[model samples]
Target chain A: MATDSKQFDFGFRNGRLRVAWYALLAVLLLVGGYAMWLRLQGGMRSTNLTSITPWGAWVAFYIYFVGLSAGAFLVSTLANVFGIERLHRVDRDALFAAIVSMVVALLFVWTDLGRMDRMWHPFAWRQVTSALSWEVHAYVAYIFVLMTELYFSMRYDLARVAERGTGLRARLAGLLTLGRRQLTDESREADRTWLKRAGIVGIPLAIFMVHGGTGVLFAVSKARPYWNSGLFPVIFIISAVLSGTALVMLLYVLRTRLFDGERVDRDILDRLATLLAAFVVVDVALTAIEALIAIVSLHPHEVETWRLILFGEMSWSFWWFMVGMGWVFPLVLVSKREWRRTPWLMAVAGLSVVIGIIAVRFNIVVPPQIRPVMEGLPHGSYFPSAVEWATSVGMMAVGLLLYTIGAELLPLTPLDGGDH
Target chain B: MSSNDAMPGVPDTPDRAQLDAMVDAEQADPRAELEDVDFSTELGVAMAEDAKAVSRGEITSEEYWQRYDDLAAEEFGEVYHETPNPAVDHDTAQTIEDDVAESLSCTVGSMASIAESLEEPAGDSEGASEDGEDDDHRWGMVIDLQKCVGCDSCSVACKAENRTPPGVSYNVVMEEEHGEFPNVQRTNVPRPCMQCENPPCVQVCPVSATYKMDNGVVNVDYDRCIGCRYCMIACPYGARYFDFGENYDDEVEGAGEITSPEYGVDRGEREPKKSPVGNVRKCHFCHHRLNRGEEPACVETCVGDARNMGDLDDPDSEVAEMAASTRAMQLKEGEGTDPNVYYLE
Candidate 1:
């Protein structure tokens, strides 16, 4: 563990590195807190929003994290429901990350509201006509399903860990197991059934209601022609799968090689990279078809939106971040079978997709809104203000901090008779 | 004017208190200084009581106008003809007379058919039942583009009446110029909330806070609104504006003392993050004024008199007649919004 990249180690094994990571996240949280304070005190005036461009970076980030969470949850289902044993090593960790990502996503959306205090209004009232209302309820339901699935998967391990010791880990495990100390073969079987059931329920919820519904939210707005296509939701689900696969891959590689100093699991890494590459190919095809339809339709609004994405003021984001890093670089790195087998190189590709998908979300949200809905209204122009950036960074730090803490406390690794 | 900062807990600047006192004095009720005054005529006495009832919402303005239509005409003579009232029920005889008048005025059969269509129940009207209210009145507006001089007075009038904050304009005049230098022509398009029969803002509102009223105006319940700004994006007219909590504290004296009487709710004092301050706002056809039997400020103040307001459900209403004219058109007609606002292009 004492290597040159010790500075980058995110594993909990190194005491000094753990403290450093905590200190870094604490600092970031403080900075984000200050930005959040400014946002609350100044209200929407703190941002560069106008009636012309009411939405901005926070909305993009909201959808981005929602995609990440959905993707991560779907990845977890691959093992828990589909019975893919080799994938179990990362399934529990992916579930934990999914929960944290959802919290972060909700926070980003909360900050975007003009009346942040009214965040609960969507839940309190129901409007069947609105896609966003359905999304709010779906997010809550999805989070509960994820927590239930995680609890069931970890129940047997937690009971065993609790019975074997009397230290802090034992006490934490005993508390988490909710007094269910009977670790019989029957209980284990029951836990497995419950876990499978939760996973099955979550698959459709994650695909159709959570992320796909997020896509439907945009698709239903016929006013924005760019997002009104039937392909929009399909593209969203595919990209969600892509980003989720990449995030889990990056997390696994970083934790094993840098943090734990354990021998990396080559088979799992190879499978993950292959899955990530396949998702990338599908995502690219869907995007091309979407772009082709928009261009061929020659509808002024649709044409204008694509034009803005391809060559507008923020075109560099599309070219460099979305297309170049998100699609081209990752595809190239994973294209060769030999490179896909390299854990570190595959991690790099995964990292590229994770970063690139952020740009993808931004491009989806912002470009379509830039063109005025009517003929002669002012064209929307937007760049996230300083407060927006600071708060977003802070929210990301919050998610990472929760993840780091979860990794330390939970028995997330594969069950191997207790001793690490 | 004394400098007085009436807003409590602020470090008082002497001049602020004086400014507040001056504002209060200026806003003092003129009725407080008057004694009981008797009307000289029976028609005047009856009309005064009915006006109060109209303002109080017990009776619609059309009801009051209908009661005194003959008397008003007799009292004012030729001068009364200058400003025609649309609420007067035009019977079949009057329709026949209007047919003759229409033949003399211009050649268009569409108006006759439109008037005929209004005789049937509105249940068959497309998109009318989508809002699920089949009320008697559906307020509407019509603007004559030829009469519009691109003065931007409508925009100013709207702001003055609505007391909108910076970057929030309920009405905006979008201008565009066509052709090269010698043959150049400028067209000013004054845009306001279409108050569509099927408003997308209403459809997309997650909280059901923004909705279509029975009177045909789209309204936002400030207290119920969550301020997510989804409606702003959904509105094809770009009529919706999010109040970013910006204030006119620097420019206007006592600007925050009284909120606009929007929907007749006098939301007192402009405070950051308050209901309407954080809500999505748009033109409601000057609904407060409409309740008071007055036209929207833009219609009243237009120098060219380009705008007309009336009950579109009434076949005899001026707005309905204009809406049936050959030049009448609705923006984004293909969008299937069925807007209550029309323009003579």
Candidate 2:
């Protein structure tokens, strides 16, 4: 038993290492914030954005985090709403990750808006026709739902922390509880009842309204024939699920390792890897259908966009990042029975999937803009400037920092009871 | 009570007393008063009563008027004698003449009236006479591609005339080569804004920045353009270009010295990021030259007699006849854009 505990404690030292990582992230975020300040001082001219290519890195990153947020949230909802008990261990962490990812997504989009001062117009006017206008409303609603769901899931634990009444954690827990305490069996039962109901409702809202709606945003733009597909939204939702599962698996392994806690359920991680692999297959299939329809139509604009994505300037991203790193590497890692048990190997696979999805988002945004609307008009050539890259890196660091802090402060992991 | 007060159009008299006695007898017998009374006075009173009846919704106006006419015929031997006075007709004629005289003093009002009058007459007498002449002649163009060398002189002349900033081309020549390589023959198509007969750009403009003129030229109101660049996308010819805050200061010695009052608006000097600088601009068919009673710079400088300018309604005019030519066709005929600028092969 002692040897087993010692094995579990491998490379796990609490507080010190956690504090160091947090400090590093904090520094990176500050640097990014400074870069963002520089960007605001100097207008779009400071960036390499031109009339030909109006959107660039900020837009790419905006969609990337949106995908990640949607993906992570959906995975957590699967365990909570659908009674997927195997995923329960990582579900709360997924929820926290989602909230952080969404915050980062909003920051990227906020920076991209032409007149950031008039950011209130979308909410104020509420243009029913614009997909972007609808997305703003959905994002707000989704964030509220996430927070509520997180609160319910953490309610019993928060009450425990409030009862203990020791450090900052207890104070925060008390504040979170809003002076309400429910430590009895009946009250816990009531809390569980509310959480179950909220989770059940949240499942469809997350899938159809939030993530699927985002897919509809791109799919509905008839100007872009490549994006105009009925299957695109389905693909988006599946990819969300895939990315969400992968994120949860990685976070679970990494967080457990950092906290000097018991080993994460290897069986659950392996199962998540399998689920992710399945989703990747579906995603690849849908993508194939999308490309095939475009090719068969033989429309000049569609053909040109396809050529640019497949064989032209952006092919490296498609072939190397999306197919190679995103699909093949993860598939190979998850498929091997021996490798499936290894936590670090699975983490590497999950990390690759996350990076690959970012490439996918970049490919989605930049390729379509490269081709001009008119035939004779000049085609756009775009490479994100240093400032754009720096701002993106900074925003990502901020997201990571938020997630880390939340994980450290809160009892994001499940308590040592209520197991069936 | 008093018989003298009862008579029609009489203050107090014996006739009133007599009429009153007759009215009393008519009240008793009804037919007695009808027979005794003079029909002319009765008829006039009846006509007045009929008008009142119509006003009261008792009888239709047509029936009332008809009955009045019959009564007048019986009383005066002809219905024409009681016809409404011809003075109303005379007054109406005089008012119409006054209105015409008043309106003719203003240029737009006069032009509107003249246009309304000329619609039918112009169609009838296409080549009859050119009586109405003004210093401000409406200029238009017809490019016959058969004679065009595709030398791009017209494009050069236009660039020179306008001194357009970079990325803003007022005119362009599109070349199409037909058949596969070995058997291929080239066709040169010089395109300016169709100045479309029914310009889609003018229709979709939210600000009314672009509009069709009476002289068949589709013109842009530069000052009104919000620089939204919607019109640039709407044009089928890709004729419209956005002025992306560029300047001709580097390319030409004094290009920015004086701005062309192209739309007849005297914008003083071309400045960076100014109204027209950011707005969408296209060929106005040279409105400035048209105001000066000269052809467009492109037409005037064409080496070949390839360009023709005339009223399309006049069949005798070169444009009207050429527009009907077997060799002529508008670009993108399938689109139903109805381009005013026709090409002759």
Q: Report the number of the highest-DockQ candidate.
A: 1
TM-score between model 1 and native: 0.82
Model 2, range B184-247, lDDT digits (tens) per residue? 9776767787877767566545456577776667777665655434354346566777665566
Q: Which residue segments of model 2 deviate by more than 4 Å?
A: A1-16, A417-420, B1-345
Worst lDDT run of 10 residues, candidate 1 chain A, spans A1-10
- lDDT tens digits, residue span A56-124, model 2: 788778877877888898888777777788777777889889889889999888777533454564565
True contacts kept of 2: 0.01
lDDT at residue B34 of model 2 (Cα atoms): 56
Q: Name the fnat for model 1.
A: 0.76
The sequence of per-residue lDDT tens digits that candidate 1 reaches over residues A169-200 is 67888999998888798998999899999998
lDDT of each residue in B23-101, candidate 1, tens digit only: 8988835344222433235566567778899999999977877787778888778877665443453322233345676
DockQ of 2: 0.03
Native-to-model Cα distance after best TM-score fit, residue A365 in candidate 2, in Å: 1.7
Candidate 1 error regions (>4 Å) = A1-11, A417-420, B1-135
